[model samples]
Target: MRLLAFALLSLWACGCAPALSTFQPAHVADKGHVQAELGLDVSVPTGAIASVVDAGVVLANIAESRELTEGERLTLFEAGGALALNPPSVTPHIGVGYTALDRWELNLRYTGSALRLGTRYQLLKRAKHGVDLTAGAGVGRYVIDLPVGSILGLVELEDFTRWQIDLPIQIGTAGTWYRVWGGPRLMFTTFDTALVVDLPAFTGYPGERELASFSGTGLYVGGQAGVALGYKHVFLGFELTLAEIFSSGELAVLGERAVAVDLDSFIIYPSIGLMLEF
Candidate 1:
């Protein structure tokens, strides 16, 4: 079950990217105007995260301490054991932006179990041949639940709940119907888990032992590029973003004995959406 703890912590540490948001316009919308959008995002692992996910088959075999043929290991990993931490990655998101005053914009976005609120100020409007400049900040929070199965018949394994916060600063350009933006982002994450094990039954120890919680925080920096195309009030666009966890606090697990935590540090994604403005 120590392997189980390692797997779960790895999942939490690697899964820190905030759910995706669509690219925003550099210039605020016309006063009294509103824009609504719906999209799908796909997260692609990079750096250490990518390496670990790519070696899922080997990791699964190692955790189970089983002898597996190459084909068997590949099949097992694809069937969703340790691979559960990586694939089938897609989520839906929705966002809205409202123009409050001449150069001020208010926005809200939602993806999975996460929500975000933000504001943007147009620092420089686009001229006949000049790009627009804007700066904005946003805050987001996410909650995720992962279920681990029953163990030993003496106790049942429960779900792990992950909570996270994201703060981002964006600076970029806006065009009549297209925009490109990039910036820095910060994140904090914590998790709660209830692990009940009958120590006397297995380890010859006294009674039941439980591990209640774990947490970690990190700083990440990333950038994004996107373009929109449309006519009148309807538009379509795609965006690509890349981010890396540059530094992180250690993950601490509380139980009979604490477990060590090591996490991968990179995330990348692409998103596409449709928007209607009025």
Candidate 2:
């Protein structure tokens, strides 16, 4: 039962973890110009307390059938990398971008746990000391997994997936040596999660069984800001983003009432990267 609680908490953490997106500049690259970047990201949760409370409730309900003592319930909640308020995690990312015809750009990025593809079209060129405009769209997919040991009797948490899409309008300026950009992004995401538990015949529950599963989708509006400095073919950049999510979803155990888990409404991301342009 303790192992089961730990597995549940791990799944919840993975589902709520943040994935960073690449910053898009308003100006497209020159034809045949290619850019590659490597970066690290940190997500600061502004509403982490709410997320923790939600997870705690879900875990408590799961243990209700086992008649856990209050102390055991507390311990269960704290085990297996339990959700923490304001605890931040770091992830590394890599991306490659290309420009075609000096007017169109495409970028593909991976952030360890997520994959993103984006495209942009230059709508208007920048005048001297003025801003340029670009419109673009992005799609991303993410997967999260948590595997408990076979010694624990075949408890596996896998196949937690999320898909996201966004449309952004960028307004910014680019000069020979520097660039600054900001944009408003409209986005949506959907999730599918599963938890599988298999105990040995000696443990009473002998067969494999799914403990919990859920699906949900959310819509969000966000803003991003970025700045970069270029010297020759090498550039360095930093990006910051904040978003609010309006989400609706319910988690369903095989034989229990569906539990509603409202996702965190506020999210923040900060990242820095080194880029090479050729």
Q: Give the alpha-carbon lDDT of every model.
A: 0.53, 0.61
Per-residue CA lDDT of model 1 for 157-255, tens digit only, reads 345444445554455665456555565545554443344332232233334343333234445557666777877577787877776654322322243
lDDT of 2 at 186: 81
What is the per-residue lDDT of model 2 for residues 126-158, given as tens digits with 9 covering 90 to 100?
A: 874366988988898774442222111223345
**Among all windows of ten consecutive residues in candidate 2, which has the lowest summed lDDT?**
78-87
Clashes of 1: 0
Per-structure clash totals for the candidates:
0, 0
The stretch of ten residues in a row with the least summed lDDT in candidate 1 is: 76-85
Clashing pairs in 2: none
Clashes of 2: 0
